[model samples]
Target: MKKLLIILIACVLGSNIGFGQSKTKLKEVIVRPGGQKVVLGTKREKADYGHGGAPNNPKYQTAYFIPAKGASGLIDRVGIYIFQKHSFLEFLKPSNPVYLYLYKADAKDLPGELLVPEPLVIKPKKNTHWYWVDISEYSIALPNDGLFAAVSWPKATKEDNGPYVGMTNECDSCPFYLYHFPSEPRWLKVDERMKKSVEKGNKEKLNQNLMVRLEVSLKK
Candidate 1:
């Protein structure tokens, strides 16, 4: 009887291990050699934006303008860095859902209409790292000029609870847009804020960019 129990235990352990291995393998399918993988966005991580990068009402959707890696390509996936608070109570909190959207860059280099039929709501399973979503099935056209990879982070349920997007230390050349609402709900360039800061004689620049990126496959 003891020998039989030992075999059962081994079977249980093996099954558990196989379950985890299969899950990881599924997530890693994008690492194949078929697509020309190009990480398009700031890979740097210095700090978190707006209370741990929590999505709020003012900036409903933060869209980063990523230049195309090739003359013609298609996006395999998009990713963003996320972090949580350092408090002891952080573990007790559950983060809010985030939305991932795509937009075309307008003639003025601004975010144009929505590319996807609807936003992809992302619920991150981990913290303090980059989280990516597979959208290759959409076959979104990636132009040479680039596309806007927007993260629509919802507001945190509690103060400590978060699904925050991190920020890079430098984004001087990176162009991003924000959604201004209530009075007018439209995508606006963040350049106006910098212009105001300059007008006020503030020598220091914002120099911050969202930690958002994309993996695109080059074509033609």
Candidate 2:
């Protein structure tokens, strides 16, 4: 009887081990009010394909989609907010897609918006000019490049308002740049008064207005 019990326990342990190893990797997504989804990728950047100049307006800020996943480098959300001076501008239209780039935290390239859902809104606010996005209906599996995000927008326009560049701090040492030129955005050189606000932290950060972006991930 003792030998039989030992054999049964060993069989149970082996079966559990095999089951755990064979289970498919499940992917999860987190959504922010602004519609940014951070997922875990395979490869991050894809072939370079773009044309146009950066936006002339100072309020027009660009965003680089940072994927949270690894290989395929798919993105479910693009946070529309960035650290500017001492304020935050949520997108007015939070569900509109825009062309964006994805990279590892170290700045390695990954895939673009290869397969993702569309955004939900696009309304503008007052002080700043970013649109807020709400992505509650779309979601994608995390890829191997580690989770990341991508930028998307309508076909290039001659207008002076929309963004023609996306910025990423994935490379901490270098300053983020616009897709059009090598020069950094002017906001990087915030005025002294605003610098003080950044030091003060979020308490000092205000939402003067809202800009907009797209939503492609969902949560329940």
Give the top-scoring candidate (lDDT).
Answer: 1
Q: Which lDDT values do the candidates have, in the order given?
A: 0.56, 0.29
Clashing pairs for model 1 are none
For model 2, the run of ten residues with the poorest summed lDDT: 15-24
In model 2, the runs with Cα more than 4 Å from the true position are 1-77, 82-109, 117-123, 129-132, 152-159, 163-170, 173-220
Supply the TM-score for candidate 1.
0.70
Question: What is the clash count for each candidate, in the order shown?
Answer: 0, 77
TM-score quality measure for candidate 2: 0.31
Residue 80 error for model 1, in Å?
0.6
Model 1 clash tally? Answer: 0
